[model samples]
Target: MITENQIHSLAKRWEIDQITVMREYLQILFLFYLYAQRKSDKIFFKGGTAIRFLFGSFRFSEDLDFTGTLESDEIIGLFNNACSDLNREIPAVEMENFKKKRNSIVSRIRYTPKPDTYPLGIHLEISIRERPITKAASHIETLLPVSPYPVVTHLESEEIMAEKIRALLKRAKGRDLFDLWYLLTKEVKLNWDMVKKKMEFYNDAATLTDLVSAVKAFNQKKLFDDLAKFLPRAQRKTIPGLKENILEKLGRFAVT
Candidate 1:
């Protein structure tokens, strides 16, 4: 484990809180374990955390989400073994309150580097409903110094964008909106077909009209409320006009 001083330096360099850096370190450790265990091939990493690490998104994530073919028992075992690896690396780390909730293995991962100090917690949600529709891609974990750097598996950027769009329509969370805007800023195009398929899974229709209506109807207050803790202080100022920004981008991108 890196020393507290090194962790602080990293936090300063990244312009985020020291605890967030520590949480990310824990995330890297688990990814390393997955790569080492050769289970990365079966589980595909997605969501905002993947965007932050894989594509350099400015926002941070609170949960590590994945979708794969592994059964709940297998996932629990994987998490237990990963917790062992995390404990070996950082003695203060503990995996607690694990529960299997209908097609998903959810748990809380807490890391306390020392006594009497606040622990950093990350929610782990692994959905085992299905496998990735696209071929898995690999990215080298560069945040921490893990020997033979872990080759993390994830879905293509377009596919991730598709899921984000689906999430926006289904949940309408602020983070999903921010992520969509960020992806657009990076020029990542949406896979319209994939978006339709994902929505269809919920028996919902996906069309430009529905997408526009949803974006227009977004509760500005709710968007900020959901994103309050997730976004950096500076980025929070941009939320007011975010809806218009997304609509403009969609206008250009959605033109058939």
Candidate 2:
């Protein structure tokens, strides 16, 4: 169990709120649990959380996302075991709900430290797929420097970027745009072959030009409002201009 003091220290070091720090703490704990049960090999981490934890993206993510080939029963069992292990380590943590959907398993966890306050909840979403389109997995270290846990196996950065591009075209959420912008700014090359493959999977024939046009039509006000909650207070004020900036830079990298 990570002590409150240690979590506070980490929050200070990361310059984020204590609740966000605790969420990340639990995420690491869950990752360690998966490693302990050897189920880590069956899953491939992706999405915004992976971008932050694995590749040092500046934006903070709430849910932990993964794509794995495991069956629902197997994934549920694995999560059950992981939750049991997490509870054994930190009795305050509890798995409140486990809902099995057609293509995903959603787990809601609650951390109840005191009787006076409401428990903090965190959500983990695991998408059950046949397998990763790109088998580009690698072992990588997490951002937590003091932890001695084994390296996590996740999708490679380029593959993650491709997925981010897929997400940008598929969803209206502002975070996808933000993530793509960050990846492009870092000069991370997008794997166009993988991107095309993902598009084929969805039966979408949208080209780079089409995607750029869609991005240009995004409602800036809605984007600003949607992304404001995830950013730090100092950064929140800049969201109003983020849409324009992203559109201006979109042309530079949205190339074949």
Please give the RMSD to the true structure for each candidate, in Å.
2.1, 2.5
Candidate 1 structure quality by residue, lDDT tens digits, 38-124: 565777888999898788888877888888777777777877788888788788888986787766778888887678888889889
TM-score of 1: 0.90
TM-score of 2: 0.87
Instruction: Please give, for residues 125-195, the per-residue lDDT of candidate 2 as tens digits.
Output: 88785357654544445555326664566777777777788877888688888877777778787667778
In order, the Cα lDDT scores of the candidates are: 0.80, 0.74
Return the clash pairs for model 1, or none: none
lDDT of 2: 0.74
TM-score of each: 0.90, 0.87
Q: How many backbone clashes does candidate 1 have?
A: 0
Worst 10 residues of 1 by lDDT: 137-146
Over 4 Å off in model 1, which ranges?
141-143
For residue 58, what is the lDDT in candidate 2?
67
